[model samples]
Target: MSNTAQELKAEILRLTRDYSALVHRANRAGTENSVPFEPGKTTVPYAGRVFDQDEVEAAVGATLDFWLTLGPEGEAFERELAGFLGVKHSLLVNSGSSANLIAIAALTTHKLPANRRVQPGDEVITVAAGFPTTVAPILQVGAVPVFIDNDPATGNARVEQLEAAFSPGKTKAVMMAHALGNPFDLSSVLEFCRRHDLWLIEDNCDALGCTYSMPIARANALGIIENSPGIPANGTHVTRYTGTWGDISTQSFYPPHHLTMGEGGAVNLVSRPPLKTYAASFRDWGRDCWCASGKDDTCGKRFNWKLGELPRGYDHKYIYSHLGYNLKPLDPQAAIGRQQLKKLPAFIEARKRNWEVLREGLAEFADKFDFTLPTHATGWTPEGFTWDATGCRTECSWFGFMLRVKPGAGFTHTDLARHLESKKIGNRMFFGGNLLRQPVFVQLRKDRPSSFRVLGAMPGADEIMERALFLGTYPGLTTTMLEYELQVIRDFVRQA
Candidate 1:
């Protein structure tokens, strides 16, 4: 590039920074006491994008480059994210829903041995109380989703039911999310999967910074090493991030997620190289070639591959390996992600602090409602945690503060939710609560009753569906906002 071009690029970047500062000023000024916390007036969102000039500038800089597709920014973001999560590889996708889809679809690839590959009609153990997308991929792949109950207190799958949900040689995988950023019982789930030789896919989209401690042997078996510089070197167990505990895990980078890339997600390859290849193939148009976008012939003999009865010297780039989708985010989105990633540690800390404040502030009303705090296999208290018998532990990066209206309480879930809404305080039900009760499942059951299986009646799941809701613990929630929310809740409970 000539000196004139270099100067022009610098000017463009400087102008972008100036524009970004203006945006930041406008955003802050607009939101500053914009609406007083009067009933039915102020709106406190349950989740939202919390960003500043850096993210805007990065995005504008990438747009100026005009490399619209996944490129250098995407590659760097992927590496940085994988390193943050202590995982081997992270393949970017268009959305968390697509990440879940590709993660499951990759398991069905022929790259795995026939015995290990998830075949059509095989069962995948999952919970039915959370988001639909977490379970949708199993059905999409023509596999049966074996439904299990969720623990109302934690809003996670009931781990004790693992054995009941298992079917030897028939249940091929276990795919579930860490509900609302609270991790499930990774110890029991890992043990169950290992015992049964089933694949594990942790939907880590909601719990990116959460940590779980497991026996070293088990962690190593899943290809996780506890080697962070600051963490204590305990020889017996390894404390790995939630995303690294499974054969495959996923992350969402939507505006409301832990990090924001506007609309992006990633399928993390935690255990196997072949799984990475398969997932990448599925993401990159199902082609046999491993080449990045706009590049070719990474395999050297791109014209000399013949696996599926095509001409012997057919171009490898066009060879369809598995049925797949083009689910990739743009380079500009990834550039924003790179900036967001730098802010993630602070964001996670803010979330944790906000949750603690809510927990503490609402302790007085604990008798009125069941506060759903994060739990682990090990019992926890404010002072410290007691390790489970196997020495397993969990550290959560909470996504929200869940509250379940206790049975026999004067106020019902609907009553409290309505009151919160009337106060313009945002809240959310556990996503698709009791998903089996959803219309789609009801219709499926009515039409083809054999499509999915359920374990014994899901009373716990019913409890959550009837009583559970959550409030924002995202980094965007300021102390003033939380105090106002607390006051609103206090007023509602006292009146009730």
Candidate 2:
């Protein structure tokens, strides 16, 4: 490269840094007492991106490189993300929904033995109350989604129903989310998967930093027995991040998620290399090539061997592996992700702190509302305000503070939500509560009743739909915001 080119690149990066600092300053000034909490005036968002100059600079830097497609930055971000999750591999994709698509698609690959591969019509167990994309992938791949009821308090699948949802050979996988960052019953789910030899795909988009303790036997089997820093790992159990407990896990980096990269997501392969290759193939246009972007012949025999009926020495890069989509995110998005990842620890801590404040503030009104707490394994209890972990526990980086209006409460969920909105505090319903009740699913059931199956009447899912709502626990919420939110809720309940 010419010296002039080098100088130009340096100058562009310097300007990017300056612009980023300016943006940071403007952001701080704009937010400084710009909008004081006023009931019915200032809008309190349920969740949003919380970022700084570093993210902007990284994004701008990637832009300057003008390598818009998935490349070095994406590769670096994948490595960084995999390291954070303590997983074998991570594949960047356009959205969490796409991550879900590719994760399931990977399991359907011919590379996996026929006995283990998720064939069309195979049944995948999932919760009836979750983001639709968690179940959409199953249908998209022509697999049958077996819907199970949720535990209202935890917004998780009822583990007790797993067996009922299972079909001896038809049931191939259990794909579910750690709803709103409160992990489901990992112990029960893991044991059920083991006993039935079912694959587990954890939709971890909402529960990035949440940790779950598993019994030693199960933990070891999942290869999560390796000690995590600062977390004690002794006795009959071992703690692993929720994502690691599953065969495949996914993350979202959208503005409202735990971390933001403008718009991005990842497929984390936790089990083995074969799965990673299958997932990568799906993300990278279904190419048989294992080479990174802009590379060639990663396998020495790339052009030397034949695949299927293709002639020998045919460009391996052109070889089709699985029927896949081009779901990879741009390099700049991954660049921002690399920066956001640096702040994830602090972001997670802030979320936990905010949720705790809200929980403690609402404790007095426990009679008025049934507040959702993160679920843990057996033998867990609250000592004082904190849960005492007796056997296994879930340490949640809470995504939101969920509250369900009790049946006899004078106020209804809609009433409380409106009250909060009127007070300029934002709230959100649990995503697609009782999803079967949603119009899309209603139509699917009507059009083709055999498309999906339900285990039993989803009473808990119905309860969540009727009574549950959640407040923000994102890092963007300051103490003042949280306090004001608490006051609004208190005033509403007190008035009632």
Candidate 3:
């Protein structure tokens, strides 16, 4: 590396920081920088990039290195993210959807035991609502998706239906998301999976910073031994981030997620060294070699592999192990992610606080709306949430503040969404609510009824589709912005 090149990179980064600081003040954490608030005039985004000069400088610096492909920066970010989540490994990908695709694909590999390997016609249980991609990959891999209902209150799978959704010999895995950053009924889910010897793929894209816990006895019974890093073990419970509990979990680093890498996601190998190889194979074009990008012969025997009728001593790099895709993100994006990871704890706290504020502010309208509750929450008081009898609990770094309009609230969710939009407040319905109702699924059902299975009437999912909407609880929301959102909702509810 020449001195001239080093100096040029430093100058570019310095100017990049200056440029970003000037233009991105409004995008900084709300506690750090104030964006002008004009009620009904300024747009209150549901979620957006919340970064300043640090992320910009990192991005610029990585770009200047000219290694556009996933490389040094990606490796650093993966290690940092895995460390943060207490996972064995994190494999970066282009999007959360791709991470999910790779996770599911990894399960299809022949490397696993025949009974455990997900094959065509094998069933993977998933919730009916929430993001479509979480379930899409099941069908993509030629496996059947057994759709269970979501609990509208928690916006997560109805764990009690796990047994009903399972098919004895055919059910191979469970793939579901922690909806809206709320951890699902992991205790029940884990128990069910263990009982059936099925794989668990947690789509943790929305719940990156969320924590779930069960009594130490219960956690031990389920074979979970360690709390995530930085979470104190209080002798009563085993607490871990949502992603770390499952066999393989995924994250999204898109702008709206817990952290942004422009466009990135990761597949987390939880407590397993082998899963890393399988998942990485799927993420890196199904290559048999374990070499990182731009490097070779990490395995030392790269030329000695013979599999799938390939010639003996064939270069392992060209040996295809599984049908896979190239889903890697750019190095610059990961560089930004590394910066975002540094601020993630604060971002998480902000999200939790923002959601709490919304919940408390709207408690008076509980009659008009059914607000989201943590998975084990029985009720919410001004002081705090009351727990269910399960002795299990969840702490959400909420993706959004979800609420469902009451049946007799004199207005529909659509009406309220419009009202909020008219006030320039951003909102979103639960993604692909009642996914079966979406055109893609409807056609899928019509074309091949055997392609997927639905457990029940999915009334809960239907209820969410018809009644629920969510407001942004992202870290970028300012006091003024939140106040305006609250005021608009209050006015609308009173008018109704």
Candidate 4:
């Protein structure tokens, strides 16, 4: 490229930033630039992309380079995200669903130990009250998903039911999400996985920045050595990001999640280097070769040996390993993701603050609603949370502010939802709320009785389905908008 082209690119990026600043004021982080807000008139969204010129310029610059495929920008974003989570590697994919698919598919590789590999009849344990994709991938990979109930108070798996759902020889893994950014009961879950020698796959898409800590002695017993990169050790507990505690985890970078890259997600190889190789293969069309996009063998001799009865030195790139899909996102999307990564610390803090604002404002109605608690938290006050006897603790980068309408609270959740909708205050239910009750799973049970297992009646899941709803805690919410939401809810409750 000539100097003329370089100068033109610079000029274009400067103009792009100016254009974004003028046109995207409403999309900026809260209080970054003011936007007009009206009470019960301006629509408030539950979640959305919150970006500024930095992300726009990054996206525009990557597009100008015209390397559309997953290339330099994608590699850099993968490295940055993995570093942030203190994981071995983060492989970019097209969506969180695909990331989950690749994460589970990697475990099905022939390279894994026979007993640990998730074979056709093997079972993977999961909760019954979360997103569909988290459980869909288990069935997609030909493994049964044993369903356990969730604790409605935390919107997380009821870990006490783990043994009831596990089969001595059939169960090979426990895969569950940290629902709504609240880290699940990792202490109990990890212990169960350790005792049973089962792999733990954390669906961390909703919980990018959440941290889970356990007593140093307990953490050491689980083979955890160090705290996540920048987290200071207090000499009492080993605190690490949620994704780092499990063998493998997944993240979503879609517009509604913690960050936005338009449409992107990643699979984090937490503790094992070999899992990166397996996961990368699954992400890149199931090819046995580990070469990155537009690159040759990192493994010196690409034409070294034969496998699967193929001709010796067959183009290694052509070698097929697992039945994989093409899940990679484009370079420009990753470039935007990189900018978002730079803002993540602030974004996380904003989410926490927003949750607190809503919680504190709504505390007067405690008798009519039950709010979610971080795992291991017994109660909450204006000062802080009270913990259980266990030494485990979680700091949530909350995805939403969830509340369960109390039974016989003068109105149903739907009534409250309708009132909020009338007032243009956005809300959402717990995603899929008892996924077993969904049509697809109901039909699956009829089609193949042995395909999945349910440990109990899931009364807790039923409660979430019937009573739970969540308001936005995303960084984009302005204080005025939040105040309006509080006022509307308070008015509605008072009328009821």
lDDT head-to-head 1 vs 4, winner: 4
Write down the lDDT that model 1 would get. Answer: 0.85
Clashing residue pairs found in predicted model 3: none
Pairs of residues at least 3 apart in sequence or in different chains that clash in candidate 1: none
lDDT of 1 at 312: 97
lDDT of 4: 0.93
Clashing pairs in 2: none
In the range 36-56, model 1's lDDT, one tens digit per residue, is 444356577788887777887
For 233-299, candidate 3 gives per-residue lDDT tens digits of 8999999999998899999888899999978899999987998999999988888888999999999
lDDT of 2 by residue, 1-496 (tens): 5899889877877887777666554222114433354545667788887766677778877887889999999999999888888889999999999999999999999888787899999999999987999999999999999999999878898899999999988999999999999999888898899888889999999999888876677677755567454467678778778898889999998888989887889999986888999998998888888898888878888879788899999999899978878998899999999988888888889888788788788888868888786785332223433443535578888888898999888989999998888778889999888999999999999898988999879999999999999999988776777878888888888999
TM-scores for the candidates = 0.94, 0.94, 0.99, 0.99
Task: Give me candidate 4's TM-score against the actual structure.
Answer: 0.99
lDDT of each: 0.85, 0.85, 0.93, 0.93
lDDT of 4 by residue, 1-496 (tens): 8999999999999999999989999998888355788777778989999999999999999999999999999999999999998888999999999999998999999999999899998999999999999999999999999999999999999999999888989999999999999999999999999999999999999998999999999999989979998999999999999989989999999898999899999999998899999999998889999988999877777888588999999888889888878999999999999999999999999999999999999999999999999999999999999999899999999999999999978998999999999999889999899999999989998999889999969999999999999999999999988988998999899999
C-alpha positional error of residue 91 in candidate 4 after TM-score superposition, expressed in Å? 0.6
What does candidate 4 score in Cα RMSD to the true structure?
0.8
Q: How close is candidate 2 to the true structure, as a TM-score?
A: 0.94
